[model samples]
Target: MHPHSPDESPAPRPAGSPRSIDPRRLRADDLRYLLAVSRTGRLVTAADALGVDHTTVSRRVAALEKSIGLRLIERGPDGWTLTEIGRAISDSARVIEEAIDRVVDTVEGQDSLSLHGTVRVSAPDGFGTAFATPALVRVRRHHPQLQVELITATRQLALRPSGFDLAVVIGVPAGSRLVTEHLTDYTLGLYACDDYLAKYGRPKSLAELREHPLIFYIESMLQVGDLDIERHLPGMTPAFSSTNVFAQLEATQQGAGIGVLPAFLTQRTQLRRLLPDEIDIRLPITLAVRREAVTHAAVRALWAALRQEVAERADELLLE
Candidate 1:
């Protein structure tokens, strides 16, 4: 693919342009522009992070590439993406940023270097509130300038994940480009409100449980294979369905039907677990990050905070 500089729509130069870069002419500081573009994936957003105008961001990045005699970034359908070499340069930029942060700490004392820029996180509704929220909030405590945006949804992750710096997904995807690791294992079990069981009569067995209506995700639209009800309960279908887990929970609370919900979600609710031995369905939650994004201080800190939260909340995730 031909690389297009985001700064300008230019006329093609003559063939055999020299690709050699002069080390003396290279401006190391301009690497900051490249790092900003890598983080935001657009000239305008990067400019916003740096407190500069979009055109100036473009100009500085262009100058940096010219000094190196290589195309570091190229425009794509959504925004700008880094080339292979550009990713390497971003790593170097991260090191420089770390050093700068260290220098700030030396000058101003510990926890003084406030990490700047926004870090976006994509997660499920329940996990977003229960786990990702508190963890990201702690990151803000350390680096007050860092911004965290959490997008909550229960759907399949995009093939080429763009806006978000981190993704917490339901299962380990088969063919995903992002770096993934097992975040935690959580169980889903049959749950019913006290009123529902009181009125409709509690089921003693799996067969009896299937007799009542079930409240769950819309089967047709559910992209998460791990949440498939059929895999856990054979010959069972949801009587009421919604795309959102919270909606399903609310429906279950209204005594609409029994819900197959995460154990963590029902902690404070009146929902009572049913047939724990027979109805428990365990699933894995995975954390994914872009290849180039892991180097950023904010991203690394976010993951670290998230991991610690999960570890500390082990009892909540997996009830004994």
Candidate 2:
């Protein structure tokens, strides 16, 4: 026979070895990168968000695609878009991330007050930072043994059960298992920066606001009020709009336009009440807690602290 070539002569296989192939290994980092791409929609954007270079993201994504044997993303003139496989992976990754966060929160909650376990609190983004955060600081001062975690997101925290020990929710609590505590009910009103007020003089009525530039909060769910303009204003074309209340407040402060803000947030800001006498948009505030967590020492402490804080500042927190 001719000299045996390596391809012509098969090497002995190990016992119980797969005759064909094995599934490729998947890693947490791969999942993270994939999720990042899904969120940002482009290699450059994803890389920047992850604090890596575009080429690195591109290379890692390519490797991940090969390992998984599927195309995860598609490129187009508009931007990078996720394929069905990519979307599925992203959803799975989010579940994994939330689970991991919950475990961490639980573990941290076990530490001493200085090292005490962490209590995650969620609220409307603006309210969390401006009001809830300061109140949290006060809570920490009183109970130095507990750690408080604050999560500020515009979206409702209904995705995962018990994701938070306590949440300062706007409107009524929906789930039956949740214990709802009424924090306060207040009206929403149009506000503009002092500078804007000085320049435009405040609009005296709904009809007058039609001529003024309008800034608006782009909430995922809009609950219009009884006032004619208040009900219609969000539907009206906005000159400036943002999902972030803080951004809206900043734009209003910079004299961009009038925005509807909770009376509590506006009270501390330099923005002046516009149409204060005419606009009456009521928004109810409630504190929600999982029934299981109500008796938790940390949760009860926070709930009591928040109640006292809001109670003491009720006049400033509510519309006159």
Candidate 3:
């Protein structure tokens, strides 16, 4: 006789198989999977929403039914529907989910004001250097135990739960996994050093702007297309280009060329605004973080500090 195959010890159960079950054996995963199915009414959709495969969702639902000792779902060619028992249990699952979220919020809230743990923040080079760094200095002074690592780059930082605790963004982020809050709107104006204007002759009109050398963002390295200041002055090109805003600012300060800079930078510097009356540009600022990271105390503390810092310094950030 052929040897029995170990894998054939028992055949896999088909959908809605009749079998004995123990309700007390169910776990939180079982309930959550059931809730997903209840909300979506299809295994494929539920799997997609929960970031799992349809097979996993089917197995989870089957396991939940087996543990509850009842068939809570009616599966058909069209879709799945919760039976009366399934609906009742799904309602309970929602309550359980809410309760769990509340528990997490309470724990996180209790420690929201905590002065511990490291928070990693990502922001644009200009904002990070000219604004975020100084604000963080005050945040650090208040929370001696808390540490901050500010990552600055010209391109948008890839947002991930493991990457950064928070990000200050100039444009709307692409992914759905991140939650965003409007931080503030700020203005930018064309500026040049007194020496540069004296040498190059200040342009009194938009049409005269091209006569002067311009310092602007490097086109190849530009991430946000709206940041191309030359867009406002058609046919204009930069005499000097850099990926870093601070570099452009310095170049402008050294009388290399006129550069469009944030109001906050210009207000702090002795740079003279060129055609200030004609050039009016406004950009929105947003604070973003992974939805999963919102419950962390360190993230919350940093978020509050960033908001407060922006609000307190609105005069410096926004144009008059």
User: What digit string (tens of lDDT, one per residue) describes model 1 on residues 163-277?
Assistant: 5678899988643448888999998888899999999999999889878999888899999998988898878999999988889889989999999898999989999999998
User: Model 1 reaches what TM-score against the true structure?
Assistant: 0.78
Please write out the lDDT profile of model 3 over residues 119-236, one tens digit for every residue.
6778888888867887888778876756687888766634322245578878666666578998988888899889887787989887788787888888777877667665666777
Error of 1 at 180 (Å): 2.7
Per TM-score, what order, best first?
1, 3, 2
What would the per-residue lDDT of candidate 2 be over residues 175-197, giving only the tens digit for each residue?
76578888987677788887887
TM-score of each: 0.78, 0.59, 0.63
Clashing pairs in 2: 108-117, 108-118, 109-117, 109-118, 110-117, 111-115, 111-116, 112-116, 113-145
The candidate that wins on TM-score is 1
Model 2: lDDT of residue 95: 53
The list of candidate 2 runs beyond 4 A from truth reads: 1-115, 197-201, 219-235
- lDDT for each candidate structure: 0.82, 0.67, 0.72
List RMSD in Å for every model shown.
4.0, 11.6, 11.3
Pairs that collide in candidate 3 are none
Which residue ranges in model 3 land beyond 4 Å of their true spot? 1-113, 157-162
